[model samples]
Target: MLKNKGKRAYRVLDFLHEHVIAIIIAVVVLAGVISTIAIVKGDVKTSSEKENSIQYEEMSTIYFAMDPVKSLNPLSSQDRDVYYISQLMFSSLFKLNENLNIEPDLVSSYTANSGSGTVSIKLREDAKFSDGSRVTAEDVRYTVSQILRIGDESPYYEYASKIDSVKTSGSYSLTITFENPNDAALDNLVFPIVSSSSYDDSANKIVGSGQYAYDSYDSMKLLKLKPNTYYYGGVPQNRIQFKIIQDKTKTTGLMTTDAITAYVSTAQDADSDAEDKKLKVTKIPSSELEYLGFNFDNKYLAKKEVRQAIALAIDTESLIQDNYGGAGITSDSVYFPGFLGTENKGDFYKQDQKGASELLQKSGFKDSNEDGILEDSKGRDFQLTILVNSNDGSRSDTASSISEALNQIGIKASVKKVSWAEYRSEVRSGDFDLFLGGYQFDKKYDLRSLFSKSNYLGYKNDQILASVKKLETCISAEQQKETYEKLKTMLQEELPYYSLCYKTYSFITVKEFTSTETPTFFDMYRGCDTWKWKKVVVTEQKDDE
Candidate 1:
């Protein structure tokens, strides 16, 4: 048996030896196939892992201050904080620039026909509401209706009353009929436009077409906003959060506590934040006009040449630099710079003492007794008194400067710094020759009623009336600009009032952010979409055991 087993084993070994190469090759080929499958599986996994990997995204946010409990209705809310916040959540057909110029907003093109008392406006086709509804002619008309229904209670009542009616032709086409031919429809139509489809039920929801959409709000705490997806401007990772505090006086404190990001204020003094925590500021030119007025009822002041000579003698640039903290601008008129009438005009009221002296010499005025004081042809001394509010140090100082200038010109001039009551009484009674005063006009820049204002200056001029008539017929922007030049010329000839400067307000931000266009009161968030901001991180140290 052992011999047979050995012989079989030997025979199997001999057969295996003869085909050893084929066995080895078969083993290697099997290993290669298995390894190839494993490699293919590994490559598939690597590619799938790479395809699924992605960079995370972050949403940007802004924190601001507003009245917590007050209504956020843009049309009726009188709170300035509410007004400013509404600028973020609302859209207007027109917007005011930093220079107070009327610029198109929702409207792509507009044309006014003073002869027909109608204004045709073509809305931007891309315009939409926060609710993703297309902004239509009906929405504009509906907004005007709301403003009208609010009546005098709304801050926009004056502007809304100028529109006789709003008619819609198509989704983006509309016409506004003014109550009067001379009314500036483009200026008056700047009121905020809300969604007509939702306004009946969502008036208190603060929904409108703006840079941001309302996401959440707590009356006592905060108002959260989400991006308006329907907005065609651009898709950004931005959000807006409004901190609701009761008192306007607490904005600076909230900012100091790192609870808010930015705010709009009259000046740096308005913010009570610590000096170490400084804010980046952007100045907004206001429609407030600080001017020097003349009472034409005065005997010698009634003369055109005397008023012209006095206007030339007053040094406006020096007064603005000294008394105004160099924060104001001297437009050629009582109207604001870049306003309707002063857009293209030069600095006509600059100090020209030589010209003033020459004009005085030609106007039959002389120092009769060589006492250094000039007397009129009737032997009357060139005497005047400037009235100013005693409490307003800036105006008082400006009045004093004017008095000094008049005295330097050999005239007996003095400043009458009186109490508020006395100043108001004198101004209303027209009992003074000259008064230092200011007017805070709305975004429309309409001061036409000043032309007929009685007990103020007693200024009556037929040329002014004619110029106003001409301005009424202006329909296009070019025509308005041209007609305003005529009105400026008339004002120059009459010289009823001399413009000193327009006050400017400050907008402070926690981060270094800039706007695409100069900021204005009506549209402070004009270019907020592109506003680059950085989060201010504050490190707080806790107790260590």
Candidate 2:
């Protein structure tokens, strides 16, 4: 019966095809008939009945925000907040490509000048700044000179510490002489270029030869940017909006309303918004590690047994999974995952409640009050105040979980959450026995701040310090790995900061945009150059009428 019905339908279609115009008209009518049937069957409807197609060409404004301070001139070199902006709006001789590999941006080619303490660079003749000024060797010379004169205040100061001088041979060639000959010099040259003409007054005019130019600025709330058509590389799609909408709820709301297209620092909140079906969430591995610093300055924390007991009592994995909803990787060492220093194949810490009880008992803690809480042999309860920056709920919740775990082992713990500014003050003043903190690794991967005598924790181990210095000068990758491994082992033993977890950084965008997981301020709009709104097609089956 089905085959005979198909044969009759084929015969009718063949007769319709025999008359071309009639077939066209008949197909149009058939399409209308199918459309009516689809409507009746509740399978297809007018697009106006559904969500409006996402606006694509109307200045695809992406609101990108970060938890950062307002301003520091890029020329200052030391300020990340400023460097991040500089990286986007400006270009350097060397640039990191999508694969995170070094590539040329302003300069066409480079060669190491052996024995001359210099690296010779050949500039791309056509490269010109947004102001229509030709990017010359003098620009590089002047930028390096400004960084040297600016000293420690510049974001590039540490990177520039190797540069003895920058000499321009001609309009298109430059020589970068280093104070110390190191292989990292080539990598450090990736510093964003600033116009020599504006170096003295760079804070006002941050002109460069990059994808976008500074369009407008708010006192501290925002920095608006527009595409620079004169850009030597790929042109950006639309005006870039950098907003400081720090409130998580406000950020989520903006994304839902299409007021913003991208945001930073909200893995916890983005997860909540993913259910809306209009948003896309991605977790990317970042070189960020959160830690709990144990105060070496405090008499109670000076005891190694006390530190070990606390470490054993705190269940970092459970804290990360339960409180943070598994948004991060449980850290066993100081270095974050994907970093070279990360001790991937080693065992650092594991949960053991029985072991924790034994460690506490050995540390001379007794349950003297008949309550579950343990006290020192002197009947002093093992209680301490934990301080964390109040802005992060995930960190606060992790702290609360740690507190609960410690209580399980008879250690009483309380949390003290404070404003970020106050938290910084507390960290610097050595006012807390324990504090929740995180570190952003410098280009050199320096751990000096954490173990140096100048550190907030006042934790100093001679061997660890020696190993760090060795880690700096070691040229061989194997030697470097050994030194880093040794340092990690020692740091874990010292327990300066009970390494908590490496949190995943997320960048959430709407379905209309295409973005990459690894973000770079230097080329924030690199993805935008080719991005176009794709019309998503949804098809429905028509019912026979």
Candidate 3:
């Protein structure tokens, strides 16, 4: 038995030695498969973690002093705050840059027929709505039609009123014909475009083609905006959050406490202490014209001599020095400084008390009762009330100053402070004798609203109206300049409104959100896409072991 066991062991050893190479090959192949499976599983796990670990590096918030009064719908909203936000959420056929030049936005290119008074716009194929739908000519046509249909109810009616017809030739091309040859037709096309389906229902959900889309609005307190992935301009890196605070006093506190990252204000709202804390304040000349409008229908103001006398009595230089700290540019022309019409520099009306008195006396106004107040021809005291909007302190102060100045010149004047709504109603209804107001002119400098026969002041001058008509459709730069110069001379003589100063707006932001571009009043977020937040991110890596 021992001898047979020994023989079996010897045979087993020989067989093992002969198949060693085949066994080694099998083991090596099995090990290779197992190692590949482990490596793939590890890679999948790392990719999943990386995909799920995205975190916001930084966040930004902006604080606006005024809250939007109505919905964010560009067509229906009349508030300036709404306009600012709408520019972010919607895209227009054209956009006014910081230089106030009209640049293409939604429209890739356009052609204007000067003789035909028609503009052909071709929509960009890449432009898309927030919902990822391609922006078509139908959307542009629908937006303009809605504005026209709403008439005066729509805030954009004034801009679109001249658009006689909007006809689309294809899905991406449209032509806009004007009732007359208006040189400002292209400028007026800056009105924002909405998705054609936005008006399908009564709800105010505005889907636009801008970089940002409306995320939510908590009444007057807050407005949250998110990036639009389909934005043709590319999405901004940081989301924008607008914190609306009607009280201007709390704005500084918000900035100091880091509750808000940015604020847009006038120069009067700037604080030296805030600047010490790395807050940057930038001032830009605004196109807003603050003036005093006269009711031409009033018997006392109807006379050209009386209106001119009043214009001469008020010291606009002192008004600017005292109220604006000599930081504004004063003008007598209806157009703001740097505009085409302002080149004439109508220096007819200046602070000349003697000249004012002479004009008043020639107009048959005298101190009949010797009570320091002038009397009209009929022996009635010459008293006028200057209405001012209570919300604007600078205008209110101007009204008071004018009242005091007029009283010194033997004219009894008073100031009436009223709410903005009441002020508008009174002016529109021709219920006020004189009022302090402001107007934002279009880039084309259209003066029809202030100088035409059917104007806000109920003014009617046939010659001025004709010049305005010619200015609107002149198309020739030289002719337009000549017409505006003539119109400015006529305005200086007429004295329908006393142009005081063009306002300036200051924007304050933290150092972390720095950008090279400066924003203008018309386009506050002009280069918002380039704004960046200062932050660092750390990403974890998988172990190779």
* Cα TM-score per model: 0.79, 0.63, 0.63
Candidate 1 residue 359 C-alpha distance from true site, Å:
2.5
What local distance difference test score does each model get? 0.75, 0.69, 0.76
Q: Which stretches of model 1 miss by more than 4 angstroms?
A: 1-59, 108-111, 170-172, 201-203, 235-237, 246-259, 268-278, 340-347, 453-455, 466-474, 536-545
Q: What C-alpha root-mean-square deviation, in Å, does candidate 2 show against the real structure?
A: 11.7
Order of all candidates by lDDT, from best down to worst? 3, 1, 2
Q: What is candidate 1's lDDT per residue for 376-404, written digit by digit as tens? A: 88888889999999999899999999998
The digit string of per-residue lDDT tens for model 2 on 1-545 reads: 99999999999988878888976888999999999899889898665454333333434565666444545367664534456666768888876554333457887877764445567789998887877788899998888877778788776777777778888888999878777654333557777787777554536457878777878787557778787778877677766777765565566566666666665443554565664646766665455677888888777789877788788777777776777776666655776552443446322567777887897788778898779988877787778889998898878887787788778888788899999999999889989989988776654455656677798988878888877665544134455666676777777778777777766656566566664334532333346544443333445444334
Candidate 3 per-residue C-alpha lDDT over 1-545 given as tens digits, one digit per residue, 9 for 90 to 100: 99999999999999989999998999999988887787778743533344324333565544344564666677877777777778888898987655444568988878877578888889899998888888999999999988887788776787899888899988999998888775445667888898887554245567888988878878767778888999988777767787777776567567655576666666554645457666777766677888888888888899999888888898887887787755456665767564452342433577898899999999999998898899989999999999999998888988999999888888889999999999989888898888999888766566776765667788888898878776665244456567767877887888788887777676777656677777777777766666765432446655554
- Which model, 2 or 3, shows the larger lDDT? 3
Q: What is the Å distance of residue 130 in model 2 from its true position?
A: 6.4
Number of clashing residue pairs in every model?
0, 9, 0
How accurate locally is residue 422 in candidate 1, as Cα lDDT from 0 to 100?
Answer: 96
Span of 10 residues, lowest total lDDT, candidate 2:
516-525
| Residue 4 in model 3: lDDT | 100
